[model samples]
Target: MDWDKLRIFHSVAEKGSLTHAGDVLHLSQSAVSRQIRALEESLSVTLFHRHARGLILTEQGELLFDATQQMVKRLEATAARIRDSEDGVFGELRVTTTTGFGTLWLAPRLANLYKNYPSLKIDLMLEERVLDLPMREADVAIRMKEPSQADLIRRRLMNIRMRLYASPEYLAEHGTPSTMDEFGNHRLICQQAGAAQVAAGAELVNQLMTHAVASTLTVNNYFGVLQGVLNHLGIGVLPDYIIEDFPHLQRVMPDLESGEVPVFLAYPEELRHSKRVAAFRDFVTDEIFAFRRSRQTE
Candidate 1:
């Protein structure tokens, strides 16, 4: 098949209008329409249903569009890899992780990365949903659990636990809870049961709620929980990783903690030789090491 015609057809199907696709492809509307017609003739299939409003893809068009989309992603990934310098990393790196880790841990430490690779462009996507690494949804991922995706090179970064914490002032005024039974005197701040979170975290919050706490505050993410604790709103259930960054928080009832959650850093196996991915992987590893060292000294 004619690659140029296929490309034009893909663009037209995506935009749902020949004029719009022509605008993007820098081709005249007549030229784009001619390409689409030629492509349909070669394939002997109706690629689109033309209507007064716009073009709608037929079943065959949908299939072709899917193939073209994959082709585009692969080409972009290849281009990024090519743009990366062997001696110095450059180009865009899409890194993804949970909101808590991205905001509290990774994002704050990114200054060092930028300092080392000034040319690097980082797109940090923070969300609870796991992005498809192999499909190029994201270039790298630091996940709370081991990634089960195929064709991924994964390494266990660290283990974290959901632990109870409170501000010094809050503890001083309300008194510390030495045991689970004493939790009744304090407000329990945590992620809501239905919120998108690791199962272990939600389970820990569930366990704490059974203590008959007098008051409660539930936030969707750990960032909000941290805010509530810092403001002395209540005792919060938060990941232990925050302790190094937030030394002012005091661990409440040291014995009450959730099961350990393993943290993993992963990238697609195809990105093994990518300098950008290597730089980011090394940066995160170095940061984790520094974090561990600081905790040891404390």
Candidate 2:
């Protein structure tokens, strides 16, 4: 199948009108129509049915849409690869990571990456929402949990340990809680939404009520929770990455079990062979593994 014809078909399907597709592609309306017609003939299937206001995909067209999307993406990445075949790494590295990691951890190290590879442009998105790499929403993801998708590649970056900590002033003023039973005596701060597991159509408020411990302050984010603890508002469970060096805060209990949170780096399985992606993945894995090893020594 001609890729140009498939491009026209995909554009028409996306824009829902031949005129709009022509405008987008800088082609005449009749030219767009001819391309669509050629695509349909080559496939021996009716791709779209005419409607009064817009075009609607036929059953066969719906089936082809999935394949067409992947084909177009691979083709674009291939062209970019060809153009960037010189000495240095190039093209946009679309990375998504959580806000705390992006700010405190990755952003600092990214300067070295940019210094080493001046041609590569990085677009980093810091969000709690998970982005699908294979779908091309993001080319790389540093997520808290490992992805379950069979088509994606997952690499364990590190295991983050979380421990309960409180500022010295807060402990002095409110008194320290030495045991699990003493949890009720001290104020607690936690994420508002993740406090409880709620079923669909269940009462959201009720879940919060059941899960939320009484706090001097309620936080909307992980960093906010850390800030609350830093400001001496209350005790909070903080990742070792953020709290490891703080002098004012001390572990809440010597015996309280610390929990491990696994971090993963993910990308599309197909793009493993892409030079830019492979270079990035190997560099990140080495850097993080080195960090983990240094921490172990400390």
Candidate 3:
């Protein structure tokens, strides 16, 4: 019930060593051990199993630790909200998105965001895993599909399709394919069928492979696939959004493409008023608009 003791227990459970937890809490090892002992006495339960290597949490400790972790996340979110100023956006803003989009798109455009809010610190998490925005795992997310997560403010950013592309030199050397049958002449570069990717993308690759392509280069992410295409390896199945930034890539078989995948930007409802979140949301929206305009002219 004591907040101080619970805080110490959470640290110890996380670190699995009294000394390590003590160092983090700025307390002596003896002091940390004493606090843990007192907490166990009050709860009348063994929280950890002491071993020569390190402490392991007991079943009860795991439950308590889970609760503490949630509590900490909530507290941190609250603190961040309190620190945000209406007049200026500053402090750490955790943003999550797929590696392909982050590397090929968002990361390159971040200079504009920095120019506007120089004091803002952005922690960009690039992975396929969808982080829990409501649980505070990440402050904002740009996902390939509509987020089914509840209690979040969601915006449809844009729709993207997977299309075939190759370097001009590669097409010139290999001769551009006019149909699915002609695709067999060139090596195909694409994300592996088993890799984590949008279903539409995987489906497009599957369709292409049915043509009995003679050679292939598969990467786990679109970034690698783009690299392979850029180096004149072969025609690659890549997101259409990439073509705007990589104008050197010529679209192959314009009619052959994947179904549209809707991109969404989302944040927890609680973060709707946070200046940091608002700033990021607006920046992404503006970029999307600019991208659309550029594509129209092309």
Candidate 4:
């Protein structure tokens, strides 16, 4: 199995034409065809189905293509690690976290990081999905719960709890609910019953549902719920940390909240010495420290 042939085969399968693959590989079409033939002969399988429109992979070709895709991802991961080996720290860093936190919290504080390292590039991926840090689905993650993934270095950043909130204007219009039973007079906004969210948040919303309400609004994420609350749509269940930035949000039932959801920052153990990882880790740590200090001062 020659690596060169596999490389050419991968390009040919992707492009669906020998001429196109040849163009990318800087080889003649005939030379690309020769390599494909040699690979198929060695493997004893027809790798493609030729047609008027384009080439389509046979069953075995699909298997080979999948393997090559994984290989490419692994190679990219290796290249990233090698590039990050430099202590200069001026390259791309992929960061992943929940949509609500990424958009509402971390994204705003990232300016300080960029101010420190002007040339640094950040690819922030915000989703509910848990990325595979060790396999390099993302370079690092800030998650509501500690990552259970093995071979990762993790640090507990902080804890958050879900609490009810409403804009002051909305309260001024509809008046405030002074008791749990008084919630029956206002519309309640929250994450949909089965949407992806931390257990504590869902649990708190679920408990709120047990009580009667005047109306109901359900969103899939906290960002939308925040919008609804801010616009005077309804009372929303939101994380406590958001209050630091949105102080105008009046707390409803200040004594009621979800169980503590621990926040953690994690990266692959192999990236322990990566300058990019170190830079991001320190930036986040400094931000959290500042956040904590602000909380105390208030």
Top candidate by TM-score: 3
User: Residue-wise lDDT of candidate 2 within 71-113, one digit each (tens)?
Assistant: 8777766665575465567878888988767775777677667
| Residues 259-285 of candidate 3: C-alpha lDDT, one tens digit per residue | 999999999998878999999999999
* Model 1 residue 25 CA deviation in Å: 0.4
Per-model C-alpha RMSD: 1.3, 4.9, 0.9, 2.0
Candidate 1 has which clashing residue pairs, if any?
none
Q: What ranking emerges by TM-score with the best candidate at the front?
A: 3, 1, 4, 2
Instruction: List pairs with backbone clashes in candidate 2.
Output: none
- State residue 203's C-alpha deviation in candidate 2, in Å: 20
Give lDDT: candidate 4, residue 2.
89
lDDT of 1 at 56: 96
Cα error, residue 92 of model 2, in Å, equals 0.7
What clash count does candidate 1 reach? 0
Error at 135, model 3, angstroms: 1.7
lDDT tens string, model 1, 1-298?
Answer: 8889878988898899999999999999999999998899989999999999999999999999999999988998787777764567888899999999999899999999999999999999999999999889999999999999999999999888999999999999999988777889899999888888888898888888777889999999999999999999989999998998899899998888899999999999889899999999999999999988887898
* Cα-based TM-score, every candidate: 0.96, 0.76, 0.98, 0.92
Model 1 regions more than 4 Å off: none
Tell me model 1's lDDT, rounded to 2 decimals. 0.91
lDDT of each residue in 1-298, candidate 4, tens digit only? 8889999999999999999999999999999999999999999999999899889999999999988978877888788889887678888899999999999999999999999888899999999999998778899999999889999999999988999999999999998898878888899999998899999998998888888888999999999999999899989999988988999899988888999999999998878888888999999999999888888887
RMSD of 4: 2.0
- Tell me the whole-model lDDT of each prediction, alpha carbons only: 0.91, 0.74, 0.95, 0.92
